[model samples]
Target chain A: MMNPTAAMLVIGDEILSGRTQDTNTHHLAGALTGHGIDLKEVRVVPDDTGAIIAAVQYLSDHYDHVCTSGGIGPTHDDITADAVAAAFGTPIDVRDDARALLMAHYEQAGVEMNEARLRMARIPDGAELIENPISAAPGFTLKNVHVMAGVPMIFQAMVASLLPTLSGGKPLLSRTLRLMQPEGVIAKPLAALAAEFPDLSFGSYPFYSNGTYGTNIVGRGTEASELDAAMARLAALFPMDGT
Target chain B: MMNPTAAMLVIGDEILSGRTQDTNTHHLAGALTGHGIDLKEVRVVPDDTGAIIAAVQYLSDHYDHVCTSGGIGPTHDDITADAVAAAFGTPIDVRDDARALLMAHYEQAGVEMNEARLRMARIPDGAELIENPISAAPGFTLKNVHVMAGVPMIFQAMVASLLPTLSGGKPLLSRTLRLMQPEGVIAKPLAALAAEFPDLSFGSYPFYSNGTYGTNIVGRGTEASELDAAMARLAALFPMDGT
Candidate 1:
C-alpha cells in the first residue's frame, strides 16, 4: 500500500519578499512525517487570488491532502478563503457557526466584532471547520485541502486539530551517520551500500562549518530493523575513527 | 516599469521531509530583492527526477530567471543536472571543462577523483558553468535556469557569481510601522490608508509575543518619498498610545 501524499502551499508576500522566513513548512513537514504522510511538494506563492486558486486546484487533484498556510487573516491581502472557494466552484457567505465562534470569543474578551474581524466567518459551502485554540478565527477543510492562518502559532494549532482526522500509513523511520570525510570521498562507498539495499533510500547532505567539511548520510525506510542494518553497514563502510 | 521576476526551485528530499530547514530561499529572496529582482514564487520538491524536470521547465518558462538550489552533489541522489538536461531536451555528459575544474581542485587537496566524484562534471549541453568557490563542483546555467549547490555556503557563492550577470530594475523600498493595536482593531483605518495610496502595497503582519498582540504595517513601493508619506498617514490614523 502506498503512503498518503500531501502537498503544501504557502501563500504569503512576506515570505517571497524575504521580510519573513517561513518556519511553518518545516513544522508541518516534521509533524506530517510523524503521522506517516509524505509531504511530496511545497510551493510558496504571492498573495494573488489566481495563483492561489490554480495551486489549490492542481495540488488537490494530485495529492491525497493539500495543506495551505497564510492569507486567511482579517486584512485586504487575506483572500485565500475566497480563492479556495472559487477553486471548488462553490459560493461562500458569512456562515453563522463560524461567526458565533468569533463573536463569543470577542464578546468574552470585551472586543468588538467589526467588519474586518467578521470577515473570518466567511466559509465556503460544504466545508468543515478546523478549530483554532490559539485564536478564535477557525481554519477550514474543503475536501482534502486544509486552509489555515499565516501566523506560525495559529497555523500549528490548526494542524494539530486537523492531523488526527486524516488517515495515515506506516511512519517512515530514519537513521543518520555523520562522517568527517567530504562528499566526494564518501560518495563511492555510499553508492555501493545503497545498491546493496535497493528498498531503503540513502541521502548524503554535505556541510562546511568552521573550516570542517563532512557529509551526513541519512538512511530512511519503513522497517526499523532493515533501517538499522543499513545504518550499521554505512557506519562500517565509513568508520568515524578511520577518517 | 515592472521589475524582472524570478522563481526559486529548491530540490531536496531533506527539505520536504522536515529534516532540514531551507535557508537558501530566504537568502536568495533578500539578495534578489536588493538587486531589484522580484522573487515571485518558490517551490520545494523532493529529489525525484521527473518532478525536478517539470518544475525547472515550468519555472524557466514562466519567469525571467529561475534559480535552483540543491541536488548538485556527488551522490546517487544527486540527479538535478541530469533532470535539468532532460527538461530542456538536451543530453548530459562529463564535459572537459567541468572535469578539469574538479580534477585540479581534488589534486591540489590530495584527494582521489573517483567515478562518483567525477559525476559532478556532468553538465547539460549549451550551458555556462556557475563557479563554486567553496567546493569544486560547479553549478551551471542552462538558459534562464541557474542550478547551484544545495549547501548554504556554496549556494551563496554561486548566487554571488550569477547575480552580477543578470539585468536588474529599481530596488523595492519599504517602511514599516509597528503598532501595539491588534490587527482587528486597526484593519478598517489601514484599508482606508491603503486605498489612499494605490501605487504602494501595504502588508499587515500580526504578532503575539510575551502575551502581547500587535500588528506591523509595512508599506512598500519603488518610490522612497511616497512610501514615507503613506507610513506617516498610517501612524497618524492609529496612534500607538491612543489604542
Candidate 2:
C-alpha cells in the first residue's frame, strides 16, 4: 500500500476575512511531518455547517487521516463540536469524560463554569478525547479525524497529545538547492532530471531581484536516499555562480 | 445580491510537507479583501489531479470566483493547468492567444520554448488571460476564477490587474481593539455585543506571553456606520487601558 496520507481542515471565517492569521495549520503540518505522516492537503473554510460537513466528509474518505482545527471554543460561534457530530451523522451530547476534566479545570482555576463553558464538554459519540495538557478541555479523535482547538497554545498541546498515537509512514525528506540561476534558464534541464525520479517531487520556486539573483529549487520525497541523490545531481547541473 | 465571493486553491506539496511556508494565500486574501470581494476559503492540495479536481468542483459551485497558484511551472510536477482543464471537463489544446504571447516572450528572451513551457499556454476553455506584468506568460481567468503564477511578485501583479475589473461591495470596514485580557474573560460580554449587532462579524484572536497579557478583538462589518458604532462600544468597554 502507499504511504499514509493526512489532510488538515482549518475551520474559521476569521482566517479568510484576514481578521486572524492562522498558526495552528502551520504548526500541525510541521508536527505531523515530524511524526512521519505525509500531510497531503490543507483547507480553510468558514464556520458555516455546510462547508464544515463537506470538508470533513471529503478529507476523511480521501486520506488515511484527517485533522480539523478551530471552532471548539465556548461562544455561539464555537460550533465545530456540533458540526463535527452532524458531519458523522452522530448525536452530540455532553461527553462525561470531557465534562469532568473541564469542570475540575474550572474549579481549580476558580472560574465559574457556566452553560456556555460547558459547551466545551460536548463531543461526538464513539470518539476518544485527545488530552490537552495546556488547557483542560481536550480535543477528540473520531474515526481517522482529530479535531482540535484554534488557539495556538491549546491547539499545539492537543496535537502533541495525538502525535504519539499515530502510526506513520516513511518520513518525507527534502533538500533545497539555492541556485543563483533564473528558473527560465534551468527549467528544461531540471524538468528532464525530474522525469528520471518519478518517486521524488521536484519544485522550482523562483525569486527575482534586480540586485541579487536566484530561485530556490526544492526536491522532496519520502525516501532520504533519493532526495540526497537528487540534490547531488542538482548541484552538478547548477553551480553556485550560475555556470 | 451579495458581492462575488472567491476561494483560493493553492496547489503544492511543498506547503503541506511543511518545507515551505505558503505566502501566496495571504497575499490573495488581502488583495481580495481590498477589492471589497469576500474570500470564502483557501485550500492547499498536493499536485494530484484528483485532489485538485475535487477541490475545484467544490469551490467553483459554492463561490463566485476561485483562484489558484503554483503547479503551472515547466516542471513535470507542475500539473495545475492540465488539472484545471480536467476539472472543468474542457479539452485543453494549446490556444493561439497564449502560444503567441509565450512565443513572443521566448523570442525576446532568446530561449527555445520547450514542450514543458508550452504546457503553460494550455489553459481551460473560455478563459481570458490575467496579465502578468513581471513575466510575459499570463495567468488566465476562467469564469470567476483567476489562476496566477505561484511566485509572490507575479501573483500580486496578476491580482492587481483583475481587481479593477471585479465588481466590489462596500469596502469591508474593520476596527481592532487589542487588550491583554484572555479571550474567555471577554467572551461572554463581547459575544452579546456582537449578537446585538448581528450584521457585524466579530473575531477574537488570543495571544499569550511570559511577560505580556491580552487578546486582540477585531470587529468587521460591511457598513461603515455599524463598524463605527461597534468600535465606539468596544472602545468604551475596553477603554485604552482596560486590560
Off by over 4 Å in 2: A209-213, A239-243, B91-119, B209-213, B234-243
List the TM-score for candidate 2's chain B: 0.93
All models: lDDT? 0.91, 0.81
Q: Candidate 1 on A98-188: residue-level lDDT in tens?
A: 9999989988888888999988999998899999987889999999999998899899999999999999998877888888888888888
TM-score of B chain for each model? 0.96, 0.93
For residues A32-109, what per-residue lDDT tens digits would candidate 2 score against the true structure? 777788888898988888889988998899899999999887766777888888889988889899999998987887
Question: Which CAPRI category fits model 1?
Answer: high
Clashes of each: 0, 3
Q: Model 2: per-residue lDDT, tens digit, B58-144?
A: 888988888898877766677887777787887777788988988998898677787767877887778888887776778887766
DockQ of each: 0.84, 0.55
- TM-score of candidate 1 versus the correct structure, residues matched by position: 0.97
Report, in order, each candidate's fnat: 0.77, 0.54
